[model samples]
Target chain A: MKLTRRKRNMALITMTPLVDVMMILLVFFMVTSTYLDLDMMPMVQSESEGVAAPADPAPTLLIRITASGEARLRGQPLTAQSLASALASQPRARVLILPSGGANVQALVSAIETATKAGAENLRVVRLEAAE
Target chain B: MKLKRRTQPPPQETIVSLIDVIFFLLVFFMLVGRMDATAPFEVSPPVSAAGESLPKGGTTIAVAENGALALDGEAIERPALLAHIADLLSKKPGLFVRINAHGEARLTNLLPLVTALERAGVGDVVLVITPNPA
Candidate 1:
């Protein structure tokens, strides 16, 4: 009975092995995971009727936003009010907003608001398509 | 009476089993973690109704979120971007421009630069995207 008690007390409960295994597994996952930095933007399909129309002769104003949140109109710096006034002077025809690859959504929205306030009849947001 | 203590052998715990588990997990993650390298550039280019994939190795332009312009990772000032393209055009005719924009980048930052590119005679501009890994 004393030997049995001694044997029971001697049972090992080591944790080093378990810890080693876990560490290796963690490192493995960290290296193997794909690191994608870009997020997908929401896209809306243009209506068929809109697509059928021929290109209008009226000058199309282009608005671009950069990743750092700077906004430019035709390579010129213009405030919201100035942009609005510029759009208002146009024929109220077509306004194209072409944002950079990582442009902010808020900037785009603000630009759209300015264009609409300037009485732009047709406003289209255009993105560059990746060539296959 | 004095008692004599008997020496016992150390507990037998092998690290082989633990190492095996670790190796298995390592291999599993290596296989599962394949991700697209180009997805982080965040430029969602406009897709045309008749859009087709072009071959790689085109001239690349990086439009950072801050509206900074980089041609093949080399930063260029906004005023100089057009001139740089024109110079490149003389050296390598028909060079396509690939725009890799960030998602948080504002559209206001891209429009004028693109217009400038067009004016500078960059006829072919391509956007880069990573296909969804299902």
Candidate 2:
């Protein structure tokens, strides 16, 4: 007499653990990530890549940012329009921003923006050093 | 005499759809979010329309309104922060330094730090800003 053989069923793989891990990671990223729309302005760059200084230095237009976040050009209040017209005459003027120590970062940034929009190519921020 | 009635069993819910949804959400978050070290204090960067799109990968230095400084999310003093940055510069000469300063932070605090970073031989340094104030 022949013995009867028993058939074995296939083992099913569970996805519960993988789902749990993914859920945890999703929550982690959602909680920890900041969703700010950030941009950047270059503060320092290698001088090697910069344009060489001309034999005749371009006229310098100094923009000052006061403690109250006002941009002043040559002691006169400077606006975007005024700066544009002023830059029209000497297009290659080196725009220097001398910000007051008490002024906020917004003031400095605003001054930079004004200079940039007025077609100033040689823009520089004149940083003040504290007295020892 | 009474007649007996049979009840139907509940159907098993499939988890394949759930796994697919979760996989898509996970991938979306990973792609959209930039994983950077956040400062212990709140830092709202200055706003400027002239700012260019921020490049990825850099060492961030956050400055609070009260002149408090943090390097890579850890609260640090000015001298110590500079020293740590100098060390990082030695290891990675092309290290990019980003200053994520609060909008109301004093220029005294920000400008000096930038000067120090430049003096430390950091070739690429950027001031983090935003196009929209909101």
**Each prediction's TM-score against the native?**
0.38, 0.88
Off by over 4 Å in 2: A1-8, A47-52, B1-13
- Say which docking band candidate 1 falls in: incorrect
**Candidates 1 onward: DockQ, in order:** 0.10, 0.77
Error of 1 at A77 (Å): 30
Candidate 1 deviant stretches above 4 angstroms: A1-132, B1-54
Hey, what RMSD does candidate 2 come out at?
3.3
> Candidate 2 clash total?
0
lDDT of 2 by residue, B30-89 (tens): 999988888999998988899999999989999999999999999999989989999999
> Candidate 1 lDDT, tens digit per residue, A1-132?
455543456667676867676776678578657554322222222122235656557677887766654667878764657667776677554778776656564555445555655566677777564322
Cα error, candidate 2, residue A55 (Å): 1.0
**Candidate 1 second chain TM:** 0.57
Model 2 Cα lDDT, one tens digit per residue, A54-128: 899999988988888898997899888888888898887888888899999999998888888788888889887
Residue-level error in angstroms, candidate 1, position A93: 15
Question: Ten-residue segment with the worst summed lDDT in candidate 2 chain A?
Answer: A45-54
